[model samples]
Target: MRTVADALHDRHRDQLKRSQLQAHPLLTGCAPWVIRRVAAVADEVLFPPGELLAEQGRTPGWFLLIRSGVAEVARNGALLGVVGAGDHYGEVPLLGRGAHPATVRAITPVHAWVIGAQRFVPLVDDVRPIRETLAASLAAQPALVAAARAELASRIQSMRREGSNTWPGIRPPRRRRSVRVLHVLAAIAMFVAVAVGAAAMYHPPYAVIRPGPVVDVANDIEISGAAVHPIHGRYLLVMVHTERPTLLSFATAAILGHHRPVEHVTALGGQPDVERQLHGQFTKSQQDAALAAAAALGIRPSASGALPFTVRFRDRDVVGPSGGLVYALAIEDMLSGADHAHGRTVAATGAIDPAGDVIPVGFVDDKAIAAQRAGAQVLVSPTSEVYLAADSGVRVVGASSLREALDRLAASN
Candidate 1:
């Protein structure tokens, strides 16, 4: 541990990895240290010519950097433009607070570095050189994303204009038929059917927002392996879901706080889009949870699992990455032996990067109210609005990352 040779060896290894990233134009401007940091966590993936990389209208899950070869960006059968080595897509959708605009496919043998959603913001948001470099790259290829989205919008519009949707055995009424009487007759029936169907089966647009249980990870998890189980105490993670609202639901949410998905079925193109968002958010939550836990315990993430590494999210409406920080903290607590939460009722809100930086989220005011109502004694939130809940009669602490949040809670304990 005390040898000069050990320090030199580590630096050499880091430099070697940094050199691997230098081959890509997008990362060329990034300092060796930045490249080293990025290369450490990035997983490289290869795609053969003609392989689909990402699809249109789908939620974005990864930020890809083209290490070599070329890729095509298209929408509704129209080619928008081509992205070659150094050019990339997906970052706009990755952190721009929306779904992907178009489909992407490789045109030649390609090597790319995939950055999971959890790491996107934490890795690049505050990094000026990387962020600015990416911004410029995206700016240069505006048509790739912009034209594809315009094409999709035009296609959806065309579909509506063409009126090709002919219901089986149902035809348009003739002009002389005088359908006024028929329309009046069917109005009440249509309303009743739609109302009953949505009420009984479909969830509404209004989100049910409130604070949930403060579960003690060690006590709540049923881990079979002999893991370290580091963190402790009760975690107060809030629950937010969009559902079909009845008259009573509004009243309930008024007492509980309220929110909804910005991109609903109509605006987002439909259920598949929503499902894509859910899959990306939930999957990132699990992966980042494992990564954050490993970082805290000073162990490899794969090592945290005595057997194979696996975790699952059962919630169907987890629509976004807002709960990332909470998931990471929970995983950390479950895997380490130290009691970080210290048996205190703690709640936090933020989007966690794979690197563990906590990104701010919307609805801080509403979330704070919900947290206060949920019996949370300590609320950890992004540094920007930690004081947003100070007036809510709860102890509010600001944290810029997962480690800071844990440290605040642990220090209090």
Candidate 2:
């Protein structure tokens, strides 16, 4: 009853499915029945060269398994690295509530298999080999991998107790500890500090500077350009320019890896509405409100007579009221002779608190793209934002505080 063209299509689809089953490392150990189930749920996609496979920071619908050619991974516009045949991408967001870490672009004519999450979950559940392989793959990732290992371990333990000896030579369970007794004892000694001799290397605490006499001269300067250069100097200073107090403080604190004094100034306004519109896909009034809030901060009229500080501008309007902490820090680093003068631009994002703790910001991919456009070589971000940097192929150092950022910069230089 099938026409010739229809028959050919079915044959091609079957061939592709067979290739997928044979090539995937995880599928290798799957039973024949499980493989057939996965094949039925999988779809094949062909893309022209230069096509966008996926966008950064967005949820993906499929777990892409590359079959041929190559894909370039990027965050914003910065290149993260390349993925080739037999490699899998998009597993990060597929497993979590967070957005996709990077964008994938086709570097050549390509073919790939797309498996929906709903279907993939069942396949993983039906096959132990798939679960084990995925866990092992994610094991190197501290956040996700640790959880995966723990879950896998628990599952294995439960199976052992049930007398399902699927995995042979497994060790018996160890004796349990007294949870209640340990909790009480640990709480009593929580504040005790024992003095050990100074370590061979000790990182200094991060200090945030306010509008003191030394920094007042550099507060309103405009940055002509910014780029992350190679580590030719012994120290580096990263600056963020935005009107969001929360973002500025958080960015500075996160990058510096310790609490530091932040100088506050009303410099420029940001495109909060545009950002919200782009990120949340909001309606007109909501977008307008965000824009209005961003527009509240007016731009400085001229760069003339402004301090010689490197000014960071969020939304390019120069009217935001924040980013002073980052700008001040960069200027301080430059003035303090910490190096980075030879065209190295370091990029980062965070909201600055009044107390100077750097908070996390959104659209990390866009910020990374902006940094790359400005010719940055090294980018530092909060530990939470490292995934964006990794997917974009940017060399990123993760810091929890200003001091930690400085220490990383020093070490790299």
TM-score of each: 0.48, 0.33
Model 1, C-alpha of 5: deviation from truth (Å): 49
In order, candidate lDDTs are 0.63, 0.49
Report RMSD (Å) for each prediction in the order shown. Answer: 15.1, 22.7
CA deviation > 4 Å runs, candidate 2: 3-16, 143-413
lDDT of 2 by residue, 108-189 (tens): 3456778887787676677677667776665555564343344445555766888764566877899987778778777666
Q: Tell me, by lDDT, which candidate is best.
A: 1
Model 1 error, position 191 (Å):
18
Model 1 per-residue lDDT tens digits across residues 1-413: 46999999978866655665775667776777788768866777877545677887666688887754445666675666566545666777664545567778764345677888888778887577888876776677665556445545665677787777646688788777556887887998999888776656554543343333333333433444445454445676654433445545554455654543222331223345434644465567656766665566565545444334445444433444556777777777776656667776677776676667775554455567677777778878877567556787788888878888878877887
How many collisions per candidate? 14, 48
